[model samples]
Target: MKVLVLGSGGREHALCWKLAQSPLIEKVFCAPGNAGIAEDAECIPISVNDFEALADFAQKEDIAFTIVGPEDPLAKGIVDFFEDRGLKIFGPSAKAAQIEGSKVFAKKIMAKYGIPTASFEIFDDPQKAIEYVEKKGAPIVVKADGLAAGKGVIVCDTVEEAKEAINKIMVEKAFGEAGNRVVIEECLFGEEASFMILTDGKTLFVLPSSQDHKPLLDGDKGPNTGGMGAYSPAPVVTPELEEKIMKTIMEPLIKGLAQEGIPYKGVLYAGLMIVDGEPYVLEFNCRFGDPECQPLMMRIKSDLAEIIMAALEGKLAEKKLELREEAAVCVVMASKGYPGKYEKGKVIKGLEEVGRMPGVKVFHAGTAKKDGEFVTNGGRVLGVTALGKDIPEAIDKAYEAVEKISWEGVHFRRDIGRKAIKHLPPKVLIFAGSKSDLPIIFKTEEVFQEFLVPYRIVVASSYRNPDKVRSLVKNAEEKGIKVLVAGAGLAAHLAGAIASETILPVIGLPLATGTLGGIDALLSTAQMPPGVPVATVTINGSINAAILAIQMLALSDERLQKRLLKYKKQLAEN
Candidate 1:
């Protein structure tokens, strides 16, 4: 049997290389393959988008199966084209590909199926989009409805930036027809993971979770790119998370697509945000991700040809995919400027020496053999993949290989698996109206310390120091404070004051120090205005206040959520 892989990225190279190792396959071929892919399979000269030509070549060459690598070809109806000619292919049809090809289509499906996703609104008119952004405020996301080669989504921290993104996409048509319509959504916070599965329109074969670094620089700073690097077995996606994603996002989407008569029959990629041990879909891709595929192909121990054939034959339930115990990491080496204009055609060297090392494979993305030397042909040039017993070791090995290769202007993120190395401390803020409330406020601090929830205490009277209170709350919001606790005795209003300044949840503690048995404080804090609400605890309930604040913060924090759950379980047991 002969197999043909479409596209010419590192993903296609990895797929072609893995299929070549299959004993069930007689030969492997890649269309418009890069210089590195040419080393693994027969490189053909055909554009993946030329559906008619591709179908003709597949028939003429007797290619037993064809696998589409990139979302562009799938979005362009490559699967339907091949299938119409009775040619076997692996990928979602164009109708199903719209889930990835159109943000609006994906959002509608998610909304219809009750799939967890960020709340969003679609807009074809640029002015309406700008108006929605203004109403929703800053820290929102702006996205082009159509594909923009992975650079269409803009996470804006300010409304001005979001407005600029809308103008660029819709007004200026920065991404051509892709930006004609737009989808704006609320920005969700948490770690992101790639959840991929092979499905036969019904059954699914889940792959190991992987995380892709989208930013250009280390520490997740700078503009988004196709992908800077990726690693399999992401610690962010625990077993519980995997189950939640399957039940909430992936399964619903597959069933929903089938119910709509699409019956997706290929790899379904769910871009997920794991928030507070809960999963939400960021977007969907109909094909395997690029850098993610590089690492996955390195870690998968099963025969690629057999698995894909089983999925296509609707026998996926009988098959189980095996993975190597070791973790795999892939770091992409690209031209100096990427996800934008950059100089290409720089000579890349040392690939042979790097490939000679154990557990390392260089999958070329944009390179060509010119005069017997590999020269950079696109922004993302090569993916340096490595395997090790653990993520740190895998990252180190991958970097070691990365250091071996060089070009005129090369750049990559230094912190690939750094999130797995250390966890950031959770933070909360406490504001007391008077120094007289310090004793109970100190008790709240003790509770936070016990729970390992870092906190800061401030003395600011809402009525007397309104400016100071507003400024402190604004500062805390800027510092990324997850929740706030406000303590006051007489006519307590600190919580309401703090709540008015920021969107962060606030808890109120009515102190028992003042006269009238603290009734005045309790009632004042409890009866808040219609628009401004405060979660009020009992009189002198500082401990409960701390717990409540932490609970609110844990909504987007996985570690904190676990700790809180354990504490609650202990309470029940006691």
Candidate 2:
């Protein structure tokens, strides 16, 4: 059977690539594909949004079946259009796609059906939203109601930031028409996981649980991009948690839609937060997630075309999908200044070298074949995906392949699967504003080494890269880190910033230079914002910072407490 898939990103590429491997599929065609997809399927010049043109081409080519990948076209009722034209397509209908196209619609369905989710209030007015934020306080979540290509949600740390998000989405229209309405909700604390299922309005075939890294930078800090990387199966989603999600979220959702007369079909993606070992729905996507799909495709042991056919032909209950035991990781390579203005058309090299590496597939996202060469055509350029026996090996192999590929202004997150590490949990984290603060970092390291404390040191500027600091704080907590130490010089906001983002004890080590020495930074550290508190140490006090961190950890650790006492006694005697 001949198949047609509509999309132009890494997701579509994976779908096409996998479908082409099916015994039942004789040929595969992608409406609009990137440079990498062209090798797997016949790449047509027609755009995904041009439904009429796509329908005409499908009819002309006698394409046996069609699959829709991206959300925008699906939400616009492309499935309805194709079905009306007597063409079978894979995806939810227009009305059913409101589960992703409109956040308000999805939230109502979840609430009405008793699906577990965060408490939320919808708003169309900017002023009312601002008022709501002011009353609710900080650390709340503000989301644009409609589709925003995964950039609509904002996790605000302050009332001011929440209000600004309200303004950006509702007033300034940051996401175009999609930002006209907003959903403000209480921020749920937990690690986030993505769950995807194949449903034909009844039976559900669950895919491997995966975690998507949204921030553009490593350590979970930076502005939200489409997705930086993803790994499957997510370490946080235990089997128990998966059963709960199936019982509470996925099953009810399909049943509710069926009762509402919306025949839900195709992939249903639940963006979930596993809070206190229970899954809470953050959002839902009508189709597969991009980077998540990349990793999932790499791990699939079953024929992709046959499974989708079962869903389309109402034989989903009889069909089964198998996944390889190996864990897969996908790291997105993007042009610099991505999630914003970026330069394109840079010559990309080293594709052939990467292809020779075992178990690695460079899924192209934003590239164009021009004059026999692939050139960067969009912000996210490629997804370097690899499979391994475990998460760490998969991450290593993915990064190994990622290093082989290059384009002008190419950048990607270095810590793709850092969360899946199981060797040992660090008790403390030491952060520096810059490598210039190494003198202070060395002292901090010396104390940790002497005390036999397991700690990790990172250099990230709170001002230059606030998102990195925020991500570092969040990761520290997840990694079971007890305390944090930050060192900086002038305008030292490092400690204060880290303190505000997390509840863990933070010690500030002030480094001074130039005329005022370190007094300014000392005051900045000592006098943090009214609510955000920082344990400030003296000028160039890296040793004390580490000692203070150990002291905090010692509060709950008798071994550390006794060791700390001995050290203190030795210092006094000396």
Candidate 3:
């Protein structure tokens, strides 16, 4: 199979590199790729937003899949354009991409769905915006509703700063027509983490958590560029916090979009703020983040082509993802005076030397092939990445590799993953076979809460959402699902199905329903084959199922074991 990647940056380079490694992919092509990406795949001169020409090229090259890497083309309806011509593509539609294209649209959706986000309002009139900002006070965020290449947002510390930002964006047109409308929002301050997922509109597969440094200078004390650096497996996004983000932000947003007749069909990136241990939405991106993508692609251990193909074919629910345990860090090298003015045609040196270093990769962003030499061609130039046992080691290796390559006006942040070295959570899954059984089945949630165990309750009928069930079970072990409690009535094939997909311990609760008062259910649950066994409890045994789950989890947790022992003692004393 052949694949085509859109965009000309470090993200595109990383994507092309990963896709080229797939055994299923015979060839890979990148549209207008930089000098670095040309080494990995065939570089075509076709523009990313040129839908007609790109489609023609894809058809000519027999491209099986096209992966979009930047927000500009996606915001321009690139996916819809490709699908209209009967071509397969990844990314969201123009309407759905608005979540990242227009801050006002995203805020409205979040407000409608009760998704946690900052308070704000939209305005086109400059005076009204200024008045609102003045009333709301300082320390607010002023943003351009349209794409500005990451420079459209401004954080103001005073009313004067707010007014100036509005005047520049709305009146002076600092960002061109992009500032025609603006979204003024309350400024949220916290440690920011990036959560990206691949979805088929109905089901989702979460990727490793990463954090990107957006400031142009060190210590985060400068204007925003595309991104300066990034590291994966962010410690701030603990397992419990990740679940909260998924349930509150990602799931609701996807469902709400589908409810509004717009089914999203690609990657959704949620920029989050960890405030007092609670996650809040900072922003959303339609496509993969630049520097962040560089490191994430380095850490992913699965075949990139298979995962993308599954999503395009609506089989994402059945695809399992694997990521390396080792941490990855990417330090971006940029032209001098980035997020402003800078020279671009300086020749870089020592790329081959650094690329040969163990566990290090040099992803080009803005560079051109001048004769036989590679020279800088854009503000953000390269993503220097390295893998290590932890974030600090990765950071050290990344900086060491960065030191080997040099140019006349190269700049980078030395403190890339400095703030992310802190701490991590676990989860249990409860699957109910049918909606009728959900009433008694939901009792498991109360017991889990009393035991202070984190859990997810999902309704996946073997007949209805079989694909969803298969996916949940297939990926359970990697997701840290200690135990799976499956409840059903009649045939009770839910536990059997889960057991077939994963090695995780599965507990079955046969409900007291149907003609035989759950005798038929208990018999079906307990009669699994020798190789696939499910622990069965008594009829209407949701609470006992919860207890069983806790017991299994307590094996690895001293605190939980103590709690369980206390609960058992209390039961005996009563």
TM for every model, in the order presented, reads 0.75, 0.75, 0.74
Better of 1 and 2 by lDDT: 2
lDDT score of residue 380 within candidate 3: 93
Looking at model 2, residue 186 earns an lDDT score of 90
Candidate 1 stretches with Cα past 4 Å from truth are 423-574
Ranking by lDDT: 3, 2, 1
How many clashes show up per model? 0, 1, 0
Query: Per-residue CA lDDT of candidate 3, range 1-574, in tens?
Result: 9999999999999999999999999999999898999999999998988999999999998999999998999998999899999999999999999999988889899999999988889999999999998899989999998899999999898999999999999999999989999999888888899999889887888989999999988789888888999999898988899899999999999999999988988889998888888888989998888888999999999999999999988998898889899999999999998879999789999998997899999999999989899999999999999998777568768887999999998899988987664342346788988878889888987777666566777889877789999988888888877899899988788888888888889999998778899998899999999999899999999889999998998898665686688789999999
Better of 1 and 2 by TM-score: 2
Candidate 3 Cα deviation (angstroms), residue 46: 0.8
Estimate, for each residue in 435-517, the C-alpha lDDT of model 2 and write its tens digit.
88887688887787666566788999988999888888998887888988888989888998899889888888889954789
lDDT of 1 at 360: 94
What is residue 59's positional error in candidate 3, in angstroms? Answer: 0.5
RMSD in order of candidates: 13.6, 12.9, 16.7
**Which residue pairs in candidate 3 collide?**
none
Worst 10 residues of 3 by lDDT: 418-427
